[model samples]
Target: MIKTNTKKICIVVSSLGVGGAERSSALLSEMLFDLDFDVHIVSVLDKIDYPYKGKLLNLGKLKAEDDSKMGRFKRLKIFKNYLKAHKFDYVIDNRTRIGLFKELIVSKWIYNAKNTIYCVRSYNTDMYIYPSKFFAKLLYGSAYKIVSVSKAIAEKLNNEFGFKNLEVIHNQVAIDAEELLVKKTIKDNYILFFGRLNDDIKNISLLLEAYSKSKLPHNSVKLKILGNGKDKMMLKQKSDTLGLSNHVEFLEFLVNPYPFVEAAFFTVLTSRFEGFPRALVESLSVGTPVISVDCKSGPNEIIVNEKNGLLVENHNIEALTNAMNRMLEDKNLYLQCKSNAQKSIEKFSKSTIGQQWKTILK
Candidate 1:
């Protein structure tokens, strides 16, 4: 009798950065490892921001310390050789495929289409890059499955690229009540907003504008913005100009931000779009209500208006301000929302999502 080898999986990502998509990939890798599968990760970049339970193959060292492009082709050959040696049963790719033509060529030439799973983790991804729509079919048509993190993203991809094998698998959020409810740095009653401080996509300007217009600033309730990004200085300048310098506090990115989320009266997100907003689900998991923009995707799926949290019109400053004021001042409503938060997000628990991936892989 011939013995079959234990299934080996490889998760390909840009990097294990602190972004939502990177964290989700790491979490999935962790889950696969816990299930007794041989798991490996291939990160294009060297940065490892999130924790993972896999053997890492960092390609960041391919370039010299000076970031020279001299060994680009040599690195590609090395990467292909590495994949050939491991012979992964399934390569679940989680990187953004927008403009990665060279990488796409590597994937196309080296990876078996029947054993690959391409993941699209952003809403309307084709719109992000100029030629993505035109190249979508060419890039992902060979993959066995194309997974999207939300129904919105899946539908968008299908409409734009006509991918017949597209699947929607929502990301999971796990919260240890004891860990999240533990002591936080700030002991004050405050509303929270945490993500990369990018104005164009995250539109934190909408958040700051809402906070400035809200009544909570006058009632001793503070607004805490967490996470650092390219627009930090610009956002800080805006806050100063809005006279919110005193009321709004910008906090640096914390690896563990759940404690802050748990301690907040409620968390807020004002993004233009999302594949799946992990922060909102995470906030709910930590027993904190959220107020978020009803963006292109994600939020509408998670937030049942007036149930677990409040959903405001996308980029509507007045509506967001009113929602924030309600979350702060409306004690009874706030309590009701808080009480309903955890239960509403049970579907997004790690075990439930892990089972989905297990089924698909099997």
Candidate 2:
């Protein structure tokens, strides 16, 4: 049932599969739908795995049918026509913006800059904003709003690009009651690492090294990694080289990874940098404590040292090893962290974040 006189909104995303930002975009659609807005989603790629609520414009399908130079131009014309036809009150863009000329054409010709909201979802601002200050300003300066997923990212953008129209809206977590009721399937005392297998950003190599050094291995506590990426083979080989092949288990990505998260002794993240780590928040949301490196932009905000989880100094192998050992050896500390997990992250709940979006959209 559609609400009367509802403002229409279009969400543009890179894809609806296999990435934190993509998952965030899908969740945002659901939030907008619940708010009674006429929501639409435009996925640039063909992959669609996450459940979302919106009428979809899958441009990827058209590309799959014909992927040539002229075909690309045809897709652009279709996208432009769709925007014009809908006349959406707001266009929330969640795709990575690179290549200045391409972004210029899309921003100036395709999208109505006054109503388009550009989202910056990574600490690497280069991926979202062009390198040249002048060009970046020309591309996004006129946007209705520039949403940064974390305060640190917002600060970086302001300090570097001097953009005035910036808002900080952290990524949100939806704690499903049904997922909570799902029984744990894995029968092992294991700590978990779940996210992309990419080592360039996730620094999964550090996680493998830290796990190998930790005392948990000696105690027969396994390390399980979930998700897939280009670095999967490299990581598996590294585990084998570290003689942890038998101890560490590699699992495929699941649509509902909550059961694995819930059953874990504790979840772990070792990313080199993050805009705002959904994994840490998701783990804590499930009442499972997390162990993470104090990364540049996010971990510090999420991990309240010795409260919800352990926060180790970034890139320090010894510190991470010690943190892992402490979580397993110190019984009282582990229980205390677990007890405080869910309550500490109430601020990041879907309702709270949704209200912030309401303010922006209104």
Candidate 3:
């Protein structure tokens, strides 16, 4: 009689950096470890810098960080071969559909494991979502699970690619309620927007345009941008072209963006799509009201329209403009929103979300 190996869970991701998906994976690993499951992680590139300690770790070092299909195939082969020797109860591909076909090929050929899962973190632009859905089918064919970060994303995945085994679990933050709820210095009159400018996926330009058009006094609603990106220079250039250079202030990344989240009158997020934005939840946890473009999943779920925070239609300049105007012109609304917003994060903290993961894995 053959004996079955004990369950060992491993998460395979591009890296465990300060990304929404990466943070969630790292948090889940911690939770699983606490639950006494043998948990480990595998990174595609060993050298990628991650924000937290003991969150995600690399497996056998590989040099195929290149974007080519063959290069990704080789790296996937190496990782899958390693797993073939040591069986795991569950193995998850935390990669989006960049070169997902290679993931499918290697899983089918090398591991042939009974339980495999694919996780997607974004609903991106309309242009790429269709192609990504097609590849997701090929990659996740007959898998144990196909999961997304938010209900908005899961719905899109189901309707677009027909992913049936989908689950919606929000990201769990290492939030300390006692640490976040004190009254912050009411810095006079500036609203804030924070995110990486690298891919322009955050869509800072539209936010700038809306801020510029609001005709609110600079002192009334100045925009402070945080998180550096590859497109930072162009985003700043576009702000200048639109005469918002004076209205915008860009800051370098910090150990904690919480102080900024506290200092700002409110926080804004203008992404095209998000799995579940950590910034949005963090700002709310800190008692700072948020105004976000209802990109895909996170914002609407967090903001109760006019109750806690406000949501605007995706990519609609006028809708975003109205949201800013409403928040700026209505002083009572700001105070009400801020007071109401702080309580919105009760369900998102690690304690609340960890048990959800326990159920998902079980």
lDDT of 1 by residue, 156-232 (tens): 77777788888888998865456555675677889999988888889999988989998988998888999989999
Which model scores highest in TM-score?
2
**If scored against the real structure, what TM-score would every candidate get?**
0.94, 0.98, 0.83
Question: Ten-residue segment with the worst summed lDDT in candidate 2?
Answer: 175-184
Ranked by lDDT, top first: 2, 1, 3
Clashes of each: 0, 0, 2
**Model 2 per-residue lDDT tens digits across residues 160-193:** 9999899999999885789678776678989999
**Global lDDT scores for all candidate models:** 0.83, 0.92, 0.71
What lDDT score is found at residue 73 in candidate 3? 65
TM-score between model 3 and native: 0.83
| Leading candidate by lDDT | 2
Among residues 3 or more apart in sequence or in different chains, the pairs in candidate 3 whose N, CA or C atoms overlap within 3 Å are 198-229, 198-230
